[model samples]
Target: MNNRLFLKEVDQRISQADLHKVDNAVFVLHDQLNMQVWPEWVREEKPPLVFIEAKAKGDSLPYHKKKITYVLSSMRHFAVECQQEGYPVYYYSTDQHYDDGLSDILESHPDLVLTFMTPSEWDSRERLREVKSSFGDRVKEIPNQFFFADPDAWKDNIEPGYRMEYFYRDMRKKTGYLMNGDEPEGGEWNYDEDNRESLPKGYDVPEITGVEPDDITNEVIQMVEEYHPNNFGVLDDFRYAVTREQALQLLDEFIEERLADFGPYEDAMATDEPTLFHTNLSIYLNNGLLLPWEICERAIQAYENDKAPINSVEGLVRQILGWREFVRIYYEAMMPEVRDTNFLDFDGALPELFWSGNTKMHCLQQSLKPVIEQGYSHHIQRLMVLSNFSNLTKTDPRELNKWFWLAYVDAYEWVVLPNVLGMSTFADGGILASKPYVSSGNYINKMSNYCTSCEYSVTKKTGEGACPFNYLYWNFVDEQREAFEVSGRNSFMVNMYDKKSDEDKKAIKESTNQFLNQLDRYSG
Candidate 1:
């Protein structure tokens, strides 16, 4: 046979083998949960399984190409591992709706009983419910084992008001992490106050030895490049841990090297150093290569072994057990409505600089550059730099949320909704955050080195060279003063703004208006 005909024959033989292997058992795997961390019940069955990595339709938003490659490559790697472990794997890569891909698989195997872990996102869960309705007794859904906290329990225990601190304290007690028999080990639930110090001058930032993409990942990169040419991020330098072994290795590296100072500089930003002391394990954790409990316990063990400090260990644990879990629960509790919220009613368009990183604003350019290149940015850069600019510029919360959903490798609806719409934009009306996370250029100047070489002057509050954030922040406060005055959490901000002189306020408003009017000029 010719080369093309020989390849076709090989493909046909593989398809025949896959078909013969199909049995009465089926497990549907989503892209996010791309690991073999299934429960005991799932392990009891040694049967053919299905994993779908569908290029979802109707998403006009430009997703980061690196994000797509990471998920697809990780899923493909996990499917290969499953096949090697004696499970017949039917991995589908289709540019169609997820439902269509799943339906085709189910239709092909009439005798197969479907089993799936409940999805993390509401929309996916609802779609699965519809599938379950069709399959009836043949379909079964197990509770997702990826989370340390139970969603139902979270919903039940939550009181009239939602507070992450209370939930975090409860989680600490439940898990015995940093706990000393009914009390926290450090005598406090949070070490966040000590965790906010900026990176000291001349301190050497540890270099992260990220996993090099293997043959499977290289193929995935080529696939994404050909299929998703217009995607938001660059595809080169796609270094992510696509397997459980590699994920664990990355985690070990973080615990041994970076965790020592991760606490003190967790919120700090630098001009060229994106990761700094931050753990880049979120991509692995979110994708299910690493479990949250395992990561949290490992960090705690690092503290016990004196490899890392209490503040560092506690901070890391709190993020996984506290904020991560809290945001997930919050997403589930308030979704369908949370997705539509716009408490401040700001309906501005997202700037093109968010995609191109071509703006003169140094902090934004610095933050967006990494995101555009790597589909990765530390949490501080996301919140303080990127999301803060979006909020202050009056960008629509929904648009910002979509942008985040498309941009970050770690982005998922469950995490991004609460972080962007609730915490960043205050769009959920204090559901997730007490106040808006808007800040002037002073915070950026204090936390980062970006301002030192910026085109805009951090000191100038108005006119040509003034930092956009300085005036835009005041403008946001002015526009939303009535809403801020009503809430005890934000009333102080309004009072502070009210204390500003009329001249300063007018200059701020004028500068903000001028900048807002000329946003298109700066954008791509």
Candidate 2:
């Protein structure tokens, strides 16, 4: 088949009104809610269907190449599936902004009414709003049904400064997951204590299975390479599942092979192993390839069959049902203003080492290697190594957030904002977390094997050859003493800092300042 000619024919048919028998059309965005050609409401109506996969504007932020390929290829494959089902599918690919592409579509059919599912991201939602305003009643937005929980219902239950624990419990009761009638399984709401063990030395890590790139994915990889050469991550070995079947297979593999051990080592990291018994299912989950409810149900089944521990199953379920849903609600509740939040008033620039992964710190280096290569590193690596260092050095939370948006395959504004600004950096002033996640090298050393190979000594608190996290953590504590003292959960850390001798505090402050001052010159 001549691909160029096929695309040209589709483009020509887009503007010909006589070819489309239906007046109304549903526009399917790149993220497929399911394998369906159209929503049930529109299927019987037999309206025309338009599936758009446009390359949006704003080349300023270079997305990870794998991300570009994943979204586009998945979208293209969905369009093909729709076409095979005998729907009038219009697949639009372009370099212009999404709005521009939509305008072109509007020009083709002047009287056409377009319907869409409410978008997930704030910016895209805003764009859709503008389009709606322009078209008036002709544009319709249906409630996004892709999510496991209802956002409005979740928001209604939330009080000011509501904690995720409460929301999690409510979800547990509602879903009847890990529950024995009115009581939680094992008479507990959480099994986090049992899930914090580090990976023992010489443990055999299971090989991860990944979907191979087919012709469609290969074409997308080539397009990203040629059009966005300077994108953040390398595009080689692109293995993310783009179709619903492939995604389900990947989820089954995780449940069977990795879920049993995921809980204990969920927070652990290693020098060479990036996944470390963790479910790398966030990419699939965020992209709508797998529903949160189904994933959680499968985990519960694993526990029922005695294939995995209760701790592991509950831990995995909590992330999707509790943390994931909570973050989405939080992001929606605190947007526009949340983007500019700087609770600690941190203003440091993101270091060059974050981009180059050339830092002397082995933890940061090892963590960043996977991010630059595969657009992934587990949550522990994100929290302990990347965000911890940034918080200690006072790197601007907004800058770090933007970097995360560009670097990770799973990142979306709804997910990235709360995790980075609220949870990771404490830039939201205790909105998502009671205490800052800031920690010294001790935490890293306790959790992973990274400290064993570091050039800097994890034990040294200050001066040359000392871990930068040591002094930087102390300096951050001293600098934010007033805030920490007032924080209910973090007051103990302030009291700890106050007990340190005056001489020790002074040395810590000096080392911190010296290291921060020369940070620009210390890049790899």
Candidate 3:
């Protein structure tokens, strides 16, 4: 937002004659690393590629170190690859913002017209538009090629309050993925009911074979260590794929080794098992190393070959074709307003346990530890454990959203905003989720191994030594009974809460207040 471009130096290789010789150049963001998503002119012209490593963006939050390392490393590697492929690259290691970097590029190259594909996130697109406004017709923006459906496509088809299932079915019909003529492949739009089984004891969990860091990544890791010495999480075993080929290999590995069981144990969690049959390709997919249609097609192919069940393939497809696209569109539709919406008016600060992982609660410990260590966790751990606990304790949705954005490897504002404020916390007033995803220890006990070795007893419903979730969930429901009753689908939760005896209700309130006050003492 500041005019800090004057502080940074332009690459010496980009001379005025070179700029005049170039008719057009393409601006590449950190996320748009793949050539497949480039403008059509890019391939023919083989024009200069401009990349900016904006340190200001990295400094916006105390981001996980591995996340910073992965993004910068990938961008550096892609720039190197582009140079090797006979393209001139102006790589700027700037301490300024993206707009400053773009302004410098335009000012340095007066004769050179710039072409850029639309960035995935809203803020990035807006920044680019601001730069374009300054440059007039010298800049051109193209459609984004990474996603299966354009965000604009939803303008006529859907709105904020629409359920994802309906939109997912529409996507299925539009893409003809998992569709058998007019009906769904299994005569159902979703296979979620078949995809909730817990992992069996001693199940053979496949080892994740991650991509070892190359010299480029190692350099970026050192750079991160030097610049972000005090950032969240360590970069000890950095194994994220930095290239399109490596990302494809990870996709293949997921389909071959894990896709079959992905449906059965998709929701399951275990101690020290962070991935657990889930495809850890979100890092690549969120960037442009992998495309959505290709990922969905591969899953569908696996199902058609009888290598995976329909439930597994359909579930995977639903994630990309259904949930991912839906959330992105929903974020676009509700943004700048959705970011601050707190329908429940939750005002508690995020617990210190989220950052320190200093908790006796087994589920929180197991879930938060991996995130603190690796900047990664499966969706259930995110939805059921992290967000569920935060919602029950009345943590401010914005604080939880910021923590997620700062912590996760795959997080960006566009995706994290809707999932946290809308689905996870119900901060959007049941627009994105029909009901809040709050739950007691029962769900965690059923879906994960965390409860087995927990300090708190899952068997006990309420009182001392009982699971905090049990009492906290009822307390939330009791406190928000009017809202629950107003939401037609979850009014039964209020009815269930009313059935408890007066003595039990008092115990529940007491235990929740005690736990919350203790949390506030330490964190708030």
Summarize candidate 3's per-residue lDDT along 21-137 as a digit string, tens digits.
787888899988889767666876788888887888899899999999888877877777787777888676677778788888788778878888888777788989999999999
User: What digit string (tens of lDDT, one per residue) describes model 2 on residues 1-524?
Assistant: 11242243234334422424557787776654464333676766645567655555436478898888887777766666656555667666555656556666776778777888888888878887788888788788887776767787766644336889999999899999999998999888999999888889999888788788877777777778887898788998898888878889888888989999999888888879999888888888886778888999999999999999999999999999999999888887787889999989988888888887888899998999999999999999999889999988888999999999989998888899899998999888877887788899999999998889999999999999999999999888888876575466788887788899999898898899899998862222
Give per-model TM-scores: 0.94, 0.94, 0.95
**Best by the TM-score measure:** 3
Among residues 3 or more apart in sequence or in different chains, the pairs in candidate 3 whose N, CA or C atoms overlap within 3 Å are none
Model 3 lowest lDDT segment of ten? 7-16
In model 1, how many backbone clashes occur? 0
Pairs with steric clashes in candidate 1: none
Q: Rank the candidates by lDDT, best first.
A: 3, 2, 1
Looking at model 3, how many pairs of residues clash? 0
Cα miss at 270, model 3 (Å)?
A: 1.3
As a TM-score, model 1 comes out at 0.94
Model 2 scores a TM of 0.94
